[model samples]
Target: MSAIKVNQIRAKLRQLFEAHLDLSDIGPTDGERENKILSRCLAALAIYIQTGCTEKEAAESVWDGGDDNGIDAAYFDPSDLRVVLVQSKWINKGAGEPEAKDIGAFTKGVRDIIEQDNTGFRAGLHAKFSDIALRLSSPGTSVHLVLVSTGASVLAKHGTSVLTTLLKDLNGDDPEPIASSEAMGLAEVYSGLANDPLLSNVSVDATMLDWSYVATPFPAYFGVIDGLQLKTWWKTHGKALVASNIRHSLGSTEVNNEIKQTATSTPEKFWYFNNGITLVSNEALKAPVGAASRAAGVFSFRGASIVNGAQTVSSLAKVDDDNRLAEVRVPLRVILLKSAPAGFGDEVTRTNNLQNRVEPRDFVAQDPEQRRLRQEMAIEGVDYQFVRSEDSMATATSCELIEVTTALACAAGEPNLAVQLKTGIGRFFVDLSKPPYKAVFNAGVSGARAFNAVVVHREIERWIDKKKTSMTKKSGPAWGALVHGNRVLSAAVFAKYGSGNLSQAIASFGAAFDPAVIEAHCDIVHAKMAAGIEANYPGKFLAVLFKNPSMSKNVFDLACA
Candidate 1:
């Protein structure tokens, strides 16, 4: 079976490569063996899968040659600022993984590119050197090492260890990982080929209430669907019901949980509370109930998929009480694509999910405190953008609402508040009149004070980034606490140094504000926090520990001691 599958994949690769790959640059085809040609084709196939680029583009990305380093192919994905480096190993028997030496050579080649040593590379690689270098030099750029193989097994333990060591060395003390690795064996390759859209021509039988149809911009049926009926479809089709949706059902999110709660509790009011579902199909046929009555009717849909309201459908499926579920009525719109223009189905899907999701912070835009802060900050020659939409400007003078909130949370000298912000900042913006929100943005906070706090918070972040580089593996929980519990540490810094007054501290130190003083305070606070971790919360995960109010407070108290 494995051998047959391997042969199938090889045939597919050969078919694809022959159709799209341009082999002119890899020397005369007469001199190359079939295995060697197939190996190069395998690298191009990996690139095509990774980037969704055209087959020609994937083939053009290949740089395999005698002078080529261990890198067989490389493509910079501009969409995510990721440099995808592929090292493909084609094994005819499909039995073994890449050896440790192969892994080492690949890592060394990647290191060479990262270090900007462009010497001794093949002509094909040299052609793309400048573009690759420019992207690698950009901020937020990351390296993805893809070790692709036709082997049945993945990388060995030692090979994995080598990759891990390389990642660690490349990433160093940076908060964001600079490099990561993945080994794609035959199983992965087979799965990619086998994955097809589920239920492409499914037929759904639904009874819709107050049935109505729109015929102007293409035929569309809109009505309310019974929740129980929707659940039945979910049971039958499962994920196939939403295969056309851009985003799958995100299980048990705060919004989804609320959806489940509302469906099970207040079924009648579900229509008013929910945005409802949008389904697209190639055909729709309605059964005639009566000539005078359009109140309710049975409908049949072919090639149907829920392009929107995936969460609603999923949440309804989770409702256990049939009595309550029977009362639930969900609004649904079915778009018929038979007579629609080209790409109409895609446009409908895109537009249905394109609306900006309302967030807790959006409510704060109406708060007078935000307006006051914005005005005051402008008076101080600083741009405080409290409105979420106006936060696109990347000037040094500008600070967004979230940034101000974080800085104020730290400056409040409350470890709990800082920790809360770290865990989930949404709670602080849940209600503008609430404790967390008012606690951070009350009458006492001035423009200068807010600006100063932001300055201090940014400096602490910078300090933490610098501190990360020096951390050894033995740094252990202390290092974890320092990195993960940064907000709590910020609170500790504020508690010790800026407790008197941020304005006074800024006045004393001037606008340039002493980094040396901040660094010293950070050092003291970090050491104390590390000691607290060892003495109070040994072996505890820093991420969870920092979220605990009491644990965070205890650590903060120790740091400020």
Candidate 2:
């Protein structure tokens, strides 16, 4: 059977209630097919909700229905025991809204149904709203009612007075939530976590994945086939999925690349990447990257934030409206650990309560694991734990706190031992895992700096050990979306488990990635690369692949594209 509960039914009913003025025939389909649908829906909702998904995370939200004892289905919010109720009815195409008396009858029927269902399933329901007169006396019933329908909920145009009267009623309105740097909502929480590229698995076991149903920032991408068929499909079809020309946060400001004999005094060397840019004053002959930064003793990642003195502020969020964040510099020292439960947003939002953005500085840096038995491995009915793929991810987010602590320690270059701080979110709560890491781990970054120059790809492989691989599979930004991130971006991998696979996969493609495509990509590079490099095989590192600084795209072809 389905897991749909009375409240979920309530939420579904709520939508129908609001969509139309009446909701009698629109709900509880009497035909065998509709009845089976209702029954299966009820079972599926019940089973999945019990699977550990918060009501909202279960994607069980519906509110177009009315309040009163008429709740059809709904889910509850853990942070606050806010319950959503629903009243739903299936309608065929071209059907009109039910009559006020029918709505009144169903509305009346739901109250009785609640009493009957309540006696068995949720003991709380029987106690909460089984009796109409009792619930009406408790609140205005405005706070609890939801009506759902497949079509319109226009109970009014049909000249229905009762449900219309209910529609006119309210405990009044509350402020609509706004998501800023400070506050978040139920849906935002899951969406934000889903946006994270670092996440790998969410189920109790490692194999089950929580991938996106739609296109998201850190895409939950997968392949249904293998090899050339896959690669062919990927190149032909998948490329559309990948944004080909992202407005690079870093770009060349040069008006044109043209410079004739008259303009050439002595073309000087240039260096640029995600970071800022740099160019030698001389206009003579130019040189390669090895002749530039490595010689100058500087290496950096895609730029964080850099601005002209005129911009006037360091943290752009404070100075500019909208934060002017696209392309602003960010230090690798900064790490964000966001967590939230599932099932808050049945429609517009998600579980984990968009409230995932707790202050980074708020949590005390402690390994949640090391604390030992502060909390249990969840004690709810195990069957009630199944969650939507998106909502199911909260379990793994537990690693954030400790991982951030490790990243900060590495960044600070402080002793490897533990240090603590009282954070803004909760005072005594501590972190427990060590998925810790550092961004700018070496000295080369602080020395050489850039002002402005032609932007190019960052030499990330130079810093991280690009030759190694990882035993674990994961995903996220900076994470390979196809297979788990085995080929990470750097070599200085660090984890509590140690002997880290973190940096090993630097620039390494994913499991679904075809070596032929890689070889072809290399062929493109072979023509423009530093030269003398040919056959690529047997764990060839990205660092050695384009090792030469002299690589350049053909001018004519570059223009055509």
Candidate 3:
């Protein structure tokens, strides 16, 4: 009977993978019904489902199966630096469970990959060998093996024990287990397809209690709930809960670490210590919790997302392993946005997150002037990405967070200031609040001027890249010297275009960005940069150039040259 049930599941899985692989050219008859090629394609498709990667990217990440040594598809998620090893078992038969021997074979395959057994290393895997080896060597890196099976086999107790022992042995003397295994059964597959389609339909189901109706801010509810309940909710919804967040979890930061410490050790004080979570839902309903006054009850919210409190929610979820859920309760505020203003949710997320101890770049991104400019730029069909963090740069995002600040600083006649702030972003959080520095930012400067600054900065950097890439042996060291001179170049360009008036320069940016004119100014800018660097450091290390205010001041003075 169980075998019959598994066969039904296998058929459903076959349909799911086939549909997912349809976009790719991979066909069922690729291997003439041997199913090898189809199985490999299905493995990549399964990985896409788990990681939200596009079908093409997923296919490209697959390792050729001829010498795969058990793994079918592998992708290192750049967002979290997690290596996902996907094993596809496309069993046609109605097997009730995977054979114990088969389970051992999969574990051995993982062992071979970890040990880098050249005997089974295919050319495709070999190409990625260095990256995989480096990631394995890195501390705190996590490896997850997801077994995607058409067969309905739960790893039996003995199978789990064997696999655990094998994994433990492979990890050696590491203080913490670096490897974990998961089985993606039929239900998980179906849920992945149904709930998380490529174009998602946001829906949420939450258990809210001790809630009161608030009519002032549209129709709403104010409630208090245990932190454990929130974690339990996340187990089902996961990433979907915070779909509207500007960025995903950046993994543990100092603030998040403190959140976790408070959650686990001092859970009772969580409500007072934390600001709590904010959620926006399309629709909500109230149910009586006790001899209910209409004012107090449990509210059920749908199409909900945590606009604020992503860090709080993530920290609460982590405390579950230590069984600390019992001690924590947090305040909950839900806004009824069934007919809210346009862009309200984003505004809420941006407004709330800005108050936290975030990166300096993040503060720049939160500037209203920059936000308004970004919206205007989008209207003009230009992508001005203002705040992509380091890990988030896996995909191409033009106009990074630091670059925006650099452009602003240089445009405000402070090229050396831009250079000093470029690297070691954390080192200059204090500067974000201070003088001539703050003047370059959105709050202190007009959007048009800031936008013009970015344009000039990007153009200079683009020219720099073009020049460096075409450098010969004679110019290679020269290119290296000009590397930190980006700030100098930006200042020169701004000065050339802005004509000692940043706002006036912005008003006539079209003429400033002309390729021929920009090229003509490069020689003059380089000369200014060279003179400025020599005057500032003068036989000292490059670090001394930024350390001396006189150097940046000198570079600013050269903008008119």
Candidate 4:
């Protein structure tokens, strides 16, 4: 997939060179080029969705001037109901990087459509204008909200921290403002080198373009599939494609149904059927060998909510019947496995991988079945506790993550704490990725299980390292190996932007990033958890920058000093 992204970037650059347009005529900085690249890429996707070809098919749109409403171009996929409405802008460099400015625009546009109940440009795809409008705020819905030149890189340092937090909220960050200033300490890498200027300058560098951000990458065109198959695609029914909902990752209920129907989908794992109403494991829903479990998603890869040098999962619940209340915890986790990839060894296990990384995403692109085979082999040697969640999958919510983590306090196993099991990315976050390190049985666990372990593995640091090592090759080693390689890099800065999708802006920046950065962060985060640490925070790293402007320098660099 990464290769595919590079190819797309390369081809775009090659076309520019082939045209031999006087680079001097385009006297704008790299940020301008980043904007163009993103617009063109999105234009290409719109065209492809409409005509099943590249943007060249709709070349005229590239020149169309956009307005405050923000539709640079549009496309209609005649086959399915997919209508692609593109709204993009070349905002203030990286400062605009998926920050409140863009979100405000998007939210306004969607709300206007809803309020007026106006039929947008009619398209030929299976997508309906009403559904598209509804997707504006609904989770488990499919929408490609493309915002180019809106990411933080466009701005100077102050804006970077602010915008980063804005992106986190869209992908499911905690209610608390992020530690924008706290994460500032990480500005070094994204910051930049001498000749390269600040990371802010190259934040829109097309030089690092890749196709994963594209509608479809090499080997497979997921967008095309969804475009053609979405109307009838049950899996993609309530999904959206943004910085967050990239795949058909649904909420707890959808996952629960998936798990229940396919509890026996794989022998090594079980579906965890609820007491008949939902996907919770009861006596009848028991696993033949292992136990059933529910899962959650690692929406943001940054320190979504950090307080006093600690990662805060959530503080949703407070004091329960069992006396376990207050500090909320995410259920994601990645266990160590002997069989990883060709370059994999014991050095890159799930535990080590999640310690420092954010949402590790490499494993997501693999063959689902093959990845499952690997998980079966690996879990064979590990011990697990078979526990069931009190809720069904569909109704499973943040409360579930809290419940599972709290429930695990009573869990125990033969050797190590029983690794509660779930499936897919949802389960993986709750399973091998989140910190609870216990098993849970609920309806959501079943559906996530159906997606198979690859989805789950993709969120794991070890799996991310395997994918990163296989995909990226550099003389220098990764920052945290299993840690920093799997997550996003954010620093606490002077300001923390409100919430929204940052990918569109980053993509428009002719986006190219070290995959290791995303992976390493996920790994580091997972590693930081002790056998029992909570994932809850009520402070913002960027709050300091806003509360006290005296430390502007520290805020810019994201340094605590």
Candidate 5:
């Protein structure tokens, strides 16, 4: 049975990634080497599953070539500052774990990366060495080693010990461990590939203390519930609990991490700190599980969907200590929609999420200057959306506040603004009354100016995408830097070629800017930036360099020159 499942997973993997696999560089191969190729493909699949990167990205992550280290594939997740290293074994019989020697080799490869040594790695790995090294060296950056195999079981005792010892040594006295490992066998691989279907109707049982009901508008219940119950729902149904949410749980974000830490360490204060979970359900009934009391009573919900507090529930689910979870209390509200007006559920979901976290850009929508710009852009037959809405999807004729801010940042000819964008766009929107925000969107800025900058910025992005596709193996380093320094390059192009008289230029150039001119400027800017980095910041990570204001300014200056 296990062999059948393994074969099925193998077939599915090939179907999904066969077009993405490139073995041209791997020397001549025969039937005997089929397992090796499959193993490499499995490594790519592991990357795709673990990192949520695209198939092409996963396939490109493979470094299994000549002079290859034991590491088969790797990905650097910028969101949480973590690196995922994968080693895969394809066993046709579906019976054996990775040998102890394999674990040793994998650990050594990890150590080599930790030591910043890429002397004996493959060309592809060496191409990415600097950026990976920089990411690994960053504080709070963690390493996750994944062992994927088409076997029925995980690593043997000896193999597990070898990997564990390596993680322990690397983690040492750090309060937050720097290294972790997971082994995915045949069953795990199959489940991941299958993309386990979400439960359609989630029924939850809760003990609501100090519960009260509203008889008017609609049937509603509000009370405090144990965090353990919420955790159980998350454990049983996962994303199914929040199927109706406006957004899924954003994994491992700083805010979510804080929530997790608080729940695990200081559960008693969770009720006061959290906004709590809201559920909209088809039906809710007080269960006669035991003698009813106002202090606590069991309630059952049918077709329940979490409309808000997805992050809170997910964080609670991560709490490993049940005792801590038992002490955690959360305010929960369940609204029954049987007699509610049509679309009220959606309105409930939307409004509930809106009041949770207000982004900096949200404040920009209230600015009179932004309103003026929107009206001005409307006169020119373009839609300028100052307000943020979950339902507003991007259209060719429309530009959102975020995109306009980015374009304005580039057009300002300030490398620091571009660096701020690269680091985090929230920095620009932090204070509308401040230098950065006011500097970009004040009275001097006209709708034509903003629109023109956006046009040019988008053109530059398209050119970069095309150039990346056309790059050859020999130009891999240049390609890497170009991608990493895209914002800085855009700033440089605008600084060098953007019109000084914005309103006049728009009147003359109109919406139809010359693609040839834009592409030419992009070519010059990319070449200059690449050359500058190579000459001045040798062995430096392009990502780190682009985020540094001083380095970015110097590179931008060189590019414009």
Candidate 6:
């Protein structure tokens, strides 16, 4: 957490706590009531401030009280396969960092959750038991253990070491694991919530270019935005303005390192050296600046997303408070797409971000099928969201792309392909523009049906993960040796169910199939696959089998045999 606790914002946090936590039913004495209120209030406030989940959800998500086992708030984000365990403290007495015992308690609670022994947890967790159990035991689930305190002190040295060891254990042999400890003190809490009110209305100073016009698809503009103006824009709008960017402003990258260096060292040469920021807005209105000419203009945009130059814009804002941008200016381009067709903004984002060397995941938004799927799912009365970009997937009401892709592939009669896609996304997902990538969307699966399949697919995954957990714990090395081809094992289960016929499996994907039956079938398929892997690729075969698609098909066949 950065050192930025404003007194006014601290008061706001207190006000929020007071409004949400009512201790009328819990404690009789004044001191007891205050303690109860503080505990509950801290839990709710931590969830509300840090996540995009609603305040109502935040309030109900709190699991801190009697027999809490040191857990405050637990949020399971299915979209990202992450389980966030939040521990909160309201230390208004200027107490230093929380004692090591508190950190140890949190770590023990996480271990308990992973082991499925929630006996001492708060009673409120019973209401969210299924969600918590599924996420905690799900395959490849990552943990984010966070401790939010209103005290100014950072974590003690011993507390940090305890958390680091816990993280290492949680990650195990998984390659793409994100396990970490976050200590959000007063400074970060205030900075996060205080800036939202000031960004509602942004007024920029620029000359409207005379030649700006609506060209068939959308309106476009070219202008000079003073460096001071860019700083003001970022300060007011903050990260929200670039929420659709491929990636957020990661501090001091190879590119942003240059941006910070140039913005401060040579502000005059910035315009020539740096490429301009690209923005998409719902509407753009040109304002008169001196005399408007075809060459330059000032424009005010609504509902803006900075699709490019997020790094430069963020870096420039960092150095601007020191009057480094007094004489600096940068060129900017604005595109207004008020009535643009579906997925057009995504296309613009992909095209521009490609130049910035963004990851291939950003290009997922360029597919028009996602928009169509969303529309169709809405019509079917299912609030299923299919997201393409990284930010939308994280913060919006959207499903993970891999989840949808796997579900659809399995439904299209290619369970092996589904398994390959799920396990090998890092190696194969970068080529979404090519044939096999396009086939995931063009498999003739309807949005309503695919959404239903995804639900079933997740349930199946949960069941299989439970089996894996039980087997591994009982005989660690023996089970590990048996499950050499674990990546495609679930797909083999589905492939056997489909009998190499995708249409039949899809048609069977409704409320008719009993969950008990699905779990039973998965058990048989999983066991057979484990044996097949042990007999075939007995020692360390995942590195090669998981690298290519055809290897997954071979495993599926062995499981079927």
lDDT of 1 by residue, 428-515 (tens): 8766787889998888887778878887888898898788767653234567666567888898888877655576533443455777
TM-scores for all candidates: the values are 0.63, 0.22, 0.55, 0.24, 0.56, 0.50
Per-residue lDDT value at 407 in model 3:
72
* Residue 35, model 4: Cα distance from true site in angstroms: 7.3
Residue 331 C-alpha lDDT in model 1: 92
Error of 4 at 552 (Å): 47
Ten-residue region with minimum lDDT total, candidate 3: 472-481
Candidate 5, 1-561: lDDT as tens digits:
888887887787877675687787655656646676788789988887766567788888887766666888888865335798988889888778888898788888887676556765876667677577667755446789999998845678899999988877776544446689999888778877877323337788889888888889788999999888889998887766777886666555446667788888888888888888899988877767654567887888998899988888887887889888889889999999878998988899998878657666788877999999988888877788878887564455678888999899888877888877755576576678987899899999998888888888888889987987786632323764556677888888887775574554444546456878889989998888888888898756454566677878888898899
**Candidate 4 on 92-174: residue-level lDDT in tens?**
23233344554455444433332223323333211434344434322222223333332232444544444344445323333
lDDT for predicted candidate 5 compared with the true structure: 0.78
Candidate 3 C-alpha RMSD relative to the actual structure: 13.3
TM-score winner between 1 and 3, please give it: 1
Model 3 TM-score (2 dp): 0.55
Candidate 1 has what TM-score? 0.63
- Candidate 2 local lDDT, 1-561, one digit each (tens): 112223334345233223322224345554454443442243223312222233233333322223333344544322112233444444333234434555565445333332222322244443433343233222112123433333343545543455444333221121111000111112222233233212222111001112111233311212111112112222222112111111111101111111111012221211011111111110112123443332221122121111111011111212222222222321111101121123211211122123333322233224233222112212210111111123332222122333323233322322121111100111112221222212221222110111000000112221222321331321111112111111111111211112222222212212222334333332232232212122222222222111111211121122112
Q: Which model is ahead, 3 or 6, in terms of lDDT?
A: 6
C-alpha RMSD of candidate 2: 30.1
Off by over 4 Å in 4: 1-68, 71-87, 90-103, 119-131, 134-146, 150-561
Going through the candidates in order, what is the number of backbone clashes in each?
0, 129, 0, 129, 0, 7
Error of 5 at 137 (Å): 21
Per-residue lDDT tens digits for candidate 3, residues 413-434, read: 5455555553233333334566
Task: Name the lDDT of candidate 3.
Answer: 0.60
* TM-score ranking, high to low: 1, 5, 3, 6, 4, 2
